[model samples]
Target: MSSEQQSIKPTEKQQILQMFNLLPDVLFWIKDIHSQIEYANTVYLEQVGVKNLEQALGKTDYDFFPPHIAKQFITDDKKVMDGELITDRVELNSDQKGNIAWFLTSKRPIFDEQGNITGSYGITRHLEKNSQVLSDVQAINAPVNFIKENFKSDIKIQQLADVAHLSVSALERRFKKYLMKTPKQFINQTRLEHARRLLVETQLPISEVAYQSGFIEHSYFSKQFRLLFDEQPSEVRNQNQSMNMKV
Candidate 1:
């Protein structure tokens, strides 16, 4: 349960209705049980790109939005209908305006005089500008993905060269120039690092981590961990935990 769940009272419902009337957000006051649009503040009308309150009223998502977006809205509405409230930001296209809108929305169910859920209410805020978090994340992850896709298969220097459309020597040259490592060395290093993370983040047992990290032997994994980091996997895990605690 949340603060909102615990706070709503019957007598305060009308007063709550009045409070939202002047609120700046695109606010919707709804009948919870039937999931109907009962009242919307002025901002809601503006958000829907409509000029009249009457035009926006009595219209659920189906009446006001495209089929795809309306279906998603109804899906989320069902969750609130089931008594768990959710808040999310969704980027969607509006056929009415023929443009993309990003809405930061929060919705919850409302109860009526008989304590029956009459509908749900929500507020929407427009998202602004470009968000590069997705692009940054993809760039950061591209190398790992390349390795994952190529690792288990026929990924020799020649095979990788073909994949890169470069000659073997050129591919090797770029690998060393850009990665500061030869292809084999990079693979070994990646596998070893994966071993370390799995050991630290999970209790899957050392032998399993060894195989999963692309090493055939536990002894080899242990040796590489010590040779590379000057510490065993277990020691690194303990050090990581200690550092996390201090932070």
Candidate 2:
């Protein structure tokens, strides 16, 4: 091949990675040992609210996601780097706008020619496209919807169980089986997510944000928020404000 023609040719790895861009509902990404993103498909970039892959390269999940979500991602990445193959793991992810959604993820370690593990790659499919997987957890739909709609109020496990039309124990078992969390944990998570969004988007006082998010005790709200996100509510708000100023 002529020099110019050879220069224009895509490498084998490039060709394979390009295929992922065509899968609209599937997000694909590769990350280095440190969990820095090395490559991401178009869909992955879009999901993270970046216009192009260049904006995402060299960034870790912490850059584009809430701390709680990023922590889970880092944990999974560590397992993959340690040569554990993660398959069909259900996970919650938030976009740049902090809209949370469920996705099915799989990850595997990438090895170099010398057989040393160098990095990892993962694929995440939006659960809506995977009908069978969605149906498997279909029993929780009512409860899930209830939590989303009523997170601002005092939510109870019995309320969720009634919404799902299952006994409290059965609901807990199903939650553990499908969502990997207890009913109460799910309620708290839903409330915390709401509070985080409010903190980033509104100028409300931290205590008010907690109360509006269903936590009656300010100290308890701060404790759970810090425990889950590794940051105080005021810190989250200030960080977002700084970012907005930069823009």
Backbone clashes, each candidate:
8, 0
lDDT of 2 at 189: 87
What would you estimate as the lDDT of candidate 1? 0.62
Give the residue spans of candidate 2 off by over 4 A: 1-10, 22-24, 31-37, 45-101, 106-121
- Give candidate 1's TM-score: 0.42
Q: What is the TM-score of each candidate against the true structure?
A: 0.42, 0.72
- After TM-score superposition, the amount by which residue 83's alpha carbon in candidate 2 deviates from its true location, in angstroms, is 11
User: Which candidate number has the best lDDT?
Assistant: 2
Quantify all predictions' global Cα lDDT against the true fold: 0.62, 0.85
- Clash-forming residue pairs, model 2: none
Evaluate residue 228 in candidate 1 and report its C-alpha lDDT on the 0 to 100 scale: 64
Q: After superposition, how far is residue 42 of candidate 2 from its true place, in Å?
A: 4.1
